[model samples]
Target: MKDSLELRTVTVTRYITPLREGGSLPALAEADDDFKYVLKFRGAGHGVKALIAELLGGLIARELGLKVPELVFAELDEAFGRTEADEEIQDLLQFSKGLNLALHFLSGALTFDPAAETVDDTLASKIVWLDAFITNVDRTFRNTNMLIWHKELWLIDHGAAFYFHHSFSNWEKSAETPFSFIKDHVLLPRASKLYEVDQEFKKILNRDKFVAIVDQIPTEWLEWEGSDFSANEIREVYLNFLLRRLESSTIFINEANKWRDASI
Candidate 1:
């Protein structure tokens, strides 16, 4: 495993409040490090795949020089959730009593408003490439899933990307699949440099970095489904799919250009 896999671990010290904006019902909790995080519960309806997306997507963003909030392994002790009077929250805590995921919380960060703010073309292109690469359909205009702090944009909540794992029957073919949904991406209009960004990404990102991202995920999450493949095999499948997508990114780049013209 690459040294990048050494994620900081934090124990949930307090469940401050439930963030109901998302269907998964993430929570704002304080950790032992005196820092707060938006906890993505392992036991949520989205299941472990969502947690994997958060970790993997964040790592990818960081690698590409995007400002994603710090990600860490959050340890959740069952006793910690016992005090929550909310039955729904109690269930979430109970199921998430083991290893969960957390996003390093940013206080007083202003949400991104596309209607009011213009994003840098390079930044926008890189983000659009990433979303398309992962088949993330969640970053639409209505729900940007982005924040801005200190004049820089920050990405959050990537659970909706990488949906192929819900069923692994066609995992290999998924790489060649067209990311048609990216036409509706909130930032696509600003990304007129997709091909160039892909060139840079190809030069910088390699298979080892991809392996390290998967290595950061807990074993239990990977072992649950896919009776045929072991945890390590499943990780390889993810890496291969992403690399394949990179090789064929031009298909989506043309798609985005068409969409940009039509959206006008």
Candidate 2:
């Protein structure tokens, strides 16, 4: 967390409705001072669970040397309602040249092309891999829930991952099975081609370091009304999952060292 960052309560000027036809509640909000930020809140039945998942998953991805966006704790009054009237929202939703009307979509703000692979794609693939390792099933094809900003892929909208309560028990079942980095796109031949980031990435991917990073997420963010799980409980699930995944990774790295005839 940065010391300069501030969280102030603001009234929602107007809610920008979801661009897509179906799914969860996503909104574009403008502050009284004219500062703009996208707000994704709980829908009619769903509470703040999506925000919690996004917050936690974003923290984990950043800790693992994956490129992601800068996330902050944003607060807004609960009463502000939503509408699809904003021109900026319409343009972005339609992927019209009208796209440039949005903030991150602005030139020089971020370097991501959803239709093409960019340099950041390699790292983005690794992030997707890490998400898979942790059973973050949200970043799938239909709703990639990721963005490219500052030449990096930023993870967002993770409420759909680990969504067993939402009739997605299969994803969890696979996570409980053996963890496999081989299947990870980052480990594939096309992605991580040079694997040039091995040293920098390895330094931060351990269980202890990851847990410490998770601690930095604001408690209020994690304690959403929609979530029945506690922060500690979430940490424990991820911690144990990482413990298993790392055990295998440790073996693989050691084997690589032995093959190179270096110290074990």
- Best-fitting candidate, scored by lDDT: 1
Candidate 1 residue spans exceeding 4 A from truth: none
Could you estimate the TM-score for every candidate?
0.96, 0.58
Predict model 2's lDDT versus the native: 0.46
Overall lDDT per candidate, in order of appearance? 0.87, 0.46
The stretch of ten residues in a row with the least summed lDDT in candidate 1 is 1-10
For candidate 1, give the lDDT of residue 115: 96
Counting clashing residue pairs in each candidate, in order, gives 0, 0
Give the alpha carbon lDDT tens digit for every residue of 1-264 in model 2. Answer: 643222234444544445342354355556455656555443312444455455556666666655544454444433333234665444333321111111112224442345574534356446545555455644444545556655555655555544433442333344454323333222222333123434455566776665765565455544545556787765565555555654444343333223323221
